[model samples]
Target chain A: MAETYPKETSNTVNRYKHQDPSIPVPVVLPMIGQIGHYPSDQQPHCYLHGYVSSRLMNLAASPPGIPLCVAATKLDGFVLTLTPNTHNYNYRSAILHGHGTVVDDESEKLWAMQLVTNSVVPARYEHTRVPPDNAEMASTRILKFRIESASGKVREGGPEDERKDRRREDVLAEVWTGVIPMYERLEEPVGGPYNRVGEVPGHVRRFVDGENARRWTYAVEAARKAAPIKRVKREDEG
Target chain B: MAETYPKETSNTVNRYKHQDPSIPVPVVLPMIGQIGHYPSDQQPHCYLHGYVSSRLMNLAASPPGIPLCVAATKLDGFVLTLTPNTHNYNYRSAILHGHGTVVDDESEKLWAMQLVTNSVVPARYEHTRVPPDNAEMASTRILKFRIESASGKVREGGPEDERKDRRREDVLAEVWTGVIPMYERLEEPVGGPYNRVGEVPGHVRRFVDGENARRWTYAVEAARKAAPIKRVKREDEG
Candidate 1:
């Protein structure tokens, strides 16, 4: 399937952080992000939620939202090879480029709140205290970024080594080439200080169990898949 | 202990992407990265590896190099609360602002290659084919980013709810407040197509077992800790 979004297990977003408008200072904020389409929109826009600094809020509140880019990534496995230069990772990454604006419509904001809450755990919105009071609603801030352009890439399968390394019997015998599967594993729920509920609810339990199984399977499967066409190795710096 | 760098398990880097020189297009590339201090440097800088587009390489090749931001984050858990607004995540995030340049010194490049290789799995470089041949070395590219300014944040502990929701007996009684501990889990290694080694090497096995244990412990511990001071809920939208 051509997946346009990261798996359900991923709900995090990273946006470029600019310290000052005059100086192009590159920084990124790791925040909660969900993709949703409001009633009035034809296409889905990204909704960002988290501790947004006041400067970013001000930038977004102006005419057009701050120029924003959203990136999400999930590491599947470590692809080990006969040589250090050939080592790679099985991963999925997506980036969205757009201008972000603060959402002012109350109903649209309310809808986004519900959409994001349930995105983590199904039916979580209805299960929680309904209709946030005026003060609660007033304090919340969500940035809506209508994606202008987007792209993604997925890297998978076992290691592919150079002809020199592959031909060397000594190297092949000494080096253990393979993939170390990696995934996000969710463990048992630990109740908080004031939790009164007797047992974990059905929604939470189901989310935990379902996600664990899916993430594990994906990582292992990616590790065993066929290798992609070889290209020049790109080192962070050489 | 205060960690200036991300844990050993994390070797990935995310840099802001700009498509056009004139138009600021926000983009991010997920690539392999490591931190190392060359013998000549006063302090450590970030060493980046992996497939870097020609445009980015050209930008970095310039006199000052490209303005770069590197971000790293690890999700510890999902903090569930009595109300949707109070939901949170236990995470560790770091951002570094710097200028990236192409490494011209072959000796420094070779040292970095070893520094990054061993970072993922201790002593992995020695285990692999020694001294990448001239062809192999020539094809590889790594980016050296001198650190200018950096910052990081860590959020742990279980959820904290509002007084209004905490006071409502019905809400407290129904809601299951807790944290679903999450971590990057490394599974059994699967040997590749051309592997001749009979057993998984000592280094790979130790890495998988050691990381799985450390990551799981950290996540569960974070989930049970005390929550931070109450703050206004930052919604994706209000």
Candidate 2:
């Protein structure tokens, strides 16, 4: 895990070392990432996956950052309505601003890209094709925004809910209110037909291994909760 | 739908009219999203997420006279390696650049946030509850990035394939190569558990009704193929 930018020079090695190494840094970091939504218009505001992880060049490559420090979510939902202005989507997002940096060089590039990949399947880099060449290596531009500060916001229910909200009468409205969750799951891997291999790698196994296997060490527990619920209760016939 | 920013005024309309409408606007955008890495670590890189988006925006999102654009992604994993550096993960992303506008008003704010939301979930905005109180709308920051150039990049397959790759290269390293394809699917809505009355709202239903059920949407299709095949009958089966 080599540090990419801002290398330590002979002159600056102990420039700040002698001083308080823990002086607060500025909120100079920039925000990046995507805002995802549900495929269905009805359940628009589903889940937003964004985060700001800790970035102290001194703490990278070894383990990288764990359990992302700051995260944000923007949920959205459509309001099929009688008017265009009335036609809207509900949403909420939590933006956690902080610090993080990009993996530097070819090796770290490979490591980080693989990290993102294995987030879906463990040991995935070990189970897949090696990056073709320097060109392949150069193709990916990974960046990290070290943590600084953060936040979260959301919207739920439906247009009727808001309209009833608008009325705000003593009577309770019949409009339904609830939240629809969105999830990203692993699909069964499709091994190439020509590849003459049967044994799945431990890394691949981490993602696709059959049930009753090792649990995902990373990823949010929401996914674990999303796993299949076998209702096959072995109940007493009595 | 309001079309007018809450602060829209006649003077502002005349000012905007002086500017060329098609000449492009300023917004966040990106060009080449290079994920740099360092293999053999002396020091480690942070894997910049925030500033990368910022820098990408630096390239895409405008500053003064430039147009708007964007290059956004969802960080899906952290590829773990056999040795520590070899780790990698599967991911999906889109890179775009062009005219953009930093959304700064109620109307654009409303739509921009919606656009970002629906970026992940199609038609979601129309299906959920939206805030009617103008006050809540006062603080939303939405940016409009009109894309001029764009492309897509994705990584799939497991480390097993790479292992086989290593064998062909006379590389004794039994590196695993396979996919841990990123997965995101809709979860059932936990409605009013009490179920006092009423059915699902029309807006939410649009989303749950399967905006992505067609199996041909960009978001879902990108993921579906990443899994291992179960059975191979005949190609003509389709």
Which segments of model 2 are wrong by more than 4 Å?
A: A1-174, A199-203, A209-238, B1-69, B74-92, B96-142, B146-151, B154-177, B192-197, B212-238
Supply the TM-score for candidate 2: 0.43
lDDT of each: 0.76, 0.35
- Per residue, candidate 1 scores C-alpha lDDT tens digits across A74-187 of 899999999888888888877666678888899998999998888888888998888888988889988888776566677888999888779999888899999999999999
Number of the top TM-score candidate: 1
Give the Cα RMSD of candidate 2: 18.0
Could you say which candidate leads in lDDT?
A: 1
**How does chain B score by TM in each prediction?**
0.86, 0.42
Give chain A TM for each model in order: 0.85, 0.36
CAPRI accuracy category, model 2: incorrect
How well is each residue in B162-232 modelled by candidate 2, as lDDT tens digits? 44334463333354333334434454544432222266655566666564353224333333343422221
In candidate 2, the second chain superimposes onto the true chain B with a TM-score of: 0.42
Question: Which segments of candidate 1 are over 4 A away from where they belong?
Answer: A1-22, A226-238, B1-21, B229-238
